[model samples]
Target: KISAIANEYGLSVDLQTKVWQLTVGQQQRVEILKALYREVDILIMDEPTSVLTPQEVDQLFTTLRTLVDDGLTIIFITHKLDEVMQVSDRVTVLRKGKVVATILTTKTDKPSLARLMVGREVIFRLEKSRLERREKILEVNNLQALNDRGIPAIRGVSFDLFGGEILGVAGVSGNGQHELAEALTGLRKSTKGRVFLGKKDVTNSSAREMNDLNVAHIPAERIRIGVVPALSIRENLILKKYRHSPFSYGEFLDNKEIEENACRAISDYHIDAPSCETPVKLLSGGNIQKVVLARELSENPGLIVAVHPTYGLDIGATEQVRQVLLAQRERGAAT
Candidate 1:
């Protein structure tokens, strides 16, 4: 029955596969199958494409269309204007808890919808001009690293990132991208070869050492490595510099300075939070990403190592993050 319902909704999965082993898209299909098994008339999916790739997102939309045709209504909740415009017939814009507008998708556009959601006109893209490539700011030679399972993930990798160049490492998930980023940022130990930040050899250095050298890292797993969920927004903002001056003095944290800095970052980054004292976990995924970006980029580091920086962000937040990264590069930071 489950298999029949899954097929009916254009969802197909190997019955023998465990849920843990399934891809994010497959897990979504399983969820839909479960709902169908219960004979639900309506399905509500919140940020359904948060963890999916572009191809998976398209597949999800197709499946949703099939379900809709079969008389199963789907209420798709997302902050991405493009997805809403592409997938939905009638659009409902919600700001805070109130409905701002309810109109046909064809009648509205990306810019108009963005204004309704944010209450301001937003730039969707940052204009990036070609820069003259400078000398290598960071170099990794024959690097090797092991995963948590003690299996080698990164092996014999070499790269050079020049000043004013945005080097993007593209690959599917679990393809050693995380390991490479971790190794570069000193979060994981490299078993072989070297990493040089400018003239300094920084291989196998501690994360603190990297920080001292002005190497900013926006980790892949935001909740685990980017920010502490239990900590207040103010505390998380100073996670790396809590022991430094202004934020800290004579082994004591300056609460006043920290709070003020947090407030400034919240405003500068357009982070939608009620208070700086709120726990970071209380905020939505997009807002949490904003907090991480605000803290890392505001430091004005020499080398910025960002892994999946725009992973789960909405269209507006993603554009903001990309702009910030480009701005960092324009400021002569090797990203």
Candidate 2:
């Protein structure tokens, strides 16, 4: 399996190295095989569905269903309510770093669990366009991109993202999805062809340059690209927005303004933290992702590059993330 993943990453490493080169999705698959190899009775998965696509997720669920039927104990730690409702017989909701609610999965809905966790009216679905949409927002033509290893990642891919569309790029691990996302958001330079934001050519724009153009990105690798673990939540929140916000008054930094923005994002995104002064690493995966999502989604950018936005999130969190993105799309943001 690692050798198979190596083919995707174009790495010459051994099976261990092959596993290292593969994406999170591929790694999950490898772990499953490893469990089988060792004849393990119990399988503990943390954010197991985070890196998988919808189809892959279904397949995994089916396999787990079979396993459960065969009397295997699978302990899954996640924040997704839908997954619990679907696959789990018993449900547990954790809040403030502790388990607050545990009950039968069949009796609990998203709202019930979410309200118990956060104490609020949780709308699982986003109101979206019931009408037609027009105009092309972003265009990619004959585009080619490479990963960090200087190997071809995206080869001759072309697509048009419309003015109000959530065009999900679904693929197995290492099918050029990450490279394509990087190219779209300017984290990586394209090897050939063009990328246009509306009609403006932005083929080789830098990350900073893309941000200047109201382009926001939800990076696939959250720990690597999204946040600095050591930084305070407030600091991380304003990391990208400081250059062009109330947080900056010309050449001076406005500490109060930064605090305000951070507070707003935290509250709105339901980030589970005691205060904005807390280090981002101290927060749970769901809360950390919420902070990142809030920062980008609240920006109301003209273009949002959401790569694996719901990765590492549970069903309820996944629904919220999807709702936020859908709401933005309905408001005519070219995502």
Cα TM-score per model: 0.83, 0.81
- Index of the highest-lDDT prediction: 1
Error of 2 at 56 (Å): 2.6
TM-score leader: 1
What lDDT score goes with residue 59 in model 1?
Answer: 73
Q: List the residue pairs that clash in candidate 2.
A: 79-314, 80-314, 80-315, 81-315, 81-316
Which regions in candidate 2 have their CA more than 4 angstroms from the true location?
1-20, 33-39, 61-72, 85-125, 131-134, 249-252
What C-alpha lDDT values do all the predictions have? 0.85, 0.79
lDDT of 2 by residue, 145-211 (tens): 8876677888899999887777878787678898888888888899999999989999989988898
- Clash counts for the predictions, in order: 0, 5
- Tens-place lDDT per residue, model 1, 282-303, is 9988789989988887779889
